[model samples]
Target: MASEKSVRIKDIADRLGLSMMSVSVALRGMPGVSEKTRKAVKACAAKLGYRPDPALSALADYRRRVRPTMSFAQLAFVTDYPVKDDPFWGYTNEFLYGAQKRGQEYGYNVVPFWLREGGMTRKQASSVLFNRGIKGLLIAPLPVEDGHLDDLTWKYFAAVAIGPSMASPQLDHAVFDHHHATQTVLRQLHERGYRRIGFLILRRRSTRVHHMPLDAYLGHQYRHEEDRRIEPYLPEALTAEGFWRWFDDQKPDVIVTDAPQDIPRLLAQRGLKSPLDVGLVCVSGQANELEGVSAIIQDLKAIGAAAMDRLHTNLLRHAYGPPQHAHGSHIRGHWQEGMTLKK
Candidate 1:
């Protein structure tokens, strides 16, 4: 029997007449080696009773992560938004930061690639990315629409979507769990001694995320008495008259909305005080500068990091183009205490 120190990968290379690098990659189960070569290397190692040193593997992983090696690869963070630095893209900024941070740990650089930049066509952009040795693409969330990948060369790169907003490419995706977020909001409000919880979202916006918030809130409401259930304030076009009408009619104790910041300003028109008149809980991103609104805090940075991890897996497995069966990753968020509701 060969001891771990006695037999080495160089010996395995000598036995098979293969390069030590090939043998090492094969033994580590990394890509770039053929299946036949990998099998032969494994068989030869077993025959020689070779064992790997655990200390070496740990040190390699530590160095690769903690002090990441040279950046040898790049991942394109694809987006189609016309204005890259607009305030509307704040969420995009956070997601990009997370992805870039995670990519650095794996010896990879995350670079943003605007789809409409320089008026370049999709094919031109694809060729540029491929020629630059970018084999992975992280599709950032854009407007909700089908056929997001039409006419683009899709067979070259392993791709992943940052959120549910990207409807095409049929690639793996990571998104905040909207349904879980709404459930958290409703449950937390009830626990805080508030009933008649109401939900409000734009009619058009609700459909974009598959009506998840609406469905989750409705599911919670139906479990109680009919009178305690408040119909969600979903309107095609929301106005002060319409919002106030719904509020006066439903008379909810707490109004949960996707627009916490906008709601306070709107409420001031009627001189309706929050928490004193109606509690507000936000399912969307909270404005830290704004106060008195409770919220479900989403770990968007983690979601972005997870997206990079998923894309890296596909790159490792050589899963390029659209997958036959796409997998969706849903990351849940936690509750944030605020002065919008009283205990």
Candidate 2:
């Protein structure tokens, strides 16, 4: 008997007395093969210890792509963003730019699709993707965290989400390590001799990232004297009244938040200035717009690149749909020193 290393698809087919094409289809979980035959082919291949040759697969993929009749393969980067006044839209682009650049290196195009564009329904949008022969989907983070989108025809494609923002039909995802970033921010702030630190992120931003920011603030606070622990201000709405009330009550010597630039304006309104009366450290994002605030700037482009690499692997292994054991990565960000911290 030949060693399993020498086993090929032909060997599996020969044992079952089936054609190579039928075996290929069955192994890929594609249609046109009977359910019983598909099962048998898989079992036989496993028993024979047959595996695909990576180099040959690469050549085949190249040939299939170069043919004039075949279009360059594409992956869809789907989102549900508004056409106008989209607050988070700019930040979302960092993910797209990274994924797009990485995808180009793989000879794959990453295309964006809007879920609510021109009255097209989610079901219809899915059809467009399938009809266009796209088999990979890169889901953008939802506007609101903890949302579910079950109407998608998930069975036809290999899917990955940008973050944990999606709540239902959980998919493999790549995201920044928020908890790690929080710890980093806290350590830096403490080293600056600040004792009382307060956290404030209006809206569901805290919940969106699974409350890592709020949790980190509390954890750090508890490590200090009980008098140093200040309650965080997390509200559904952003208002001056709420902000001043929280500031008066907490009187945090330094504040950690998602938006440091905007915080200064709010402080100035009450005749207070950052670094004069308070300090600010941003953990959420917008590194460029930090306005001289100490921040843990996320490498969002890396998250996009990681996601693309995962999708490429899925395409290679023929892994489609939601996975039984979904796995992914969390890219870490670096700190950017700004004027908001104490010298």
Best by TM-score: 1
- lDDT string, candidate 1, 60-141, tens digits: 7678898887845778998888776557776787788888999888777899888888898999989998888788999888
- Candidate 2 residue spans exceeding 4 A from truth: 8-44, 51-71, 82-88
lDDT, candidate 2, equals: 0.82
Tens-digit per-residue lDDT, 1-343, candidate 2: 4577898888888999999989986876544577699889989988888787879878865764464222247888888876632765878888888998888766678988787878888788889888888888999998778978788888889888998798878888998898899999889888889888888887578888888777777778778899888888888986888888998988889888886767888989978886878888888675667656788888889999999988877875568888888886888888888878887
What TM-scores do the predictions have? 0.84, 0.82
Pairs of residues at least 3 apart in sequence or in different chains that clash in candidate 2? 292-339
Candidate 1 regions with alpha-carbon error over 4 angstroms:
1-17, 23-60, 145-147, 287-290
Candidate 2 similarity to native, TM-score:
0.82
Give residue 155's lDDT in candidate 1 (0 to 100). 91
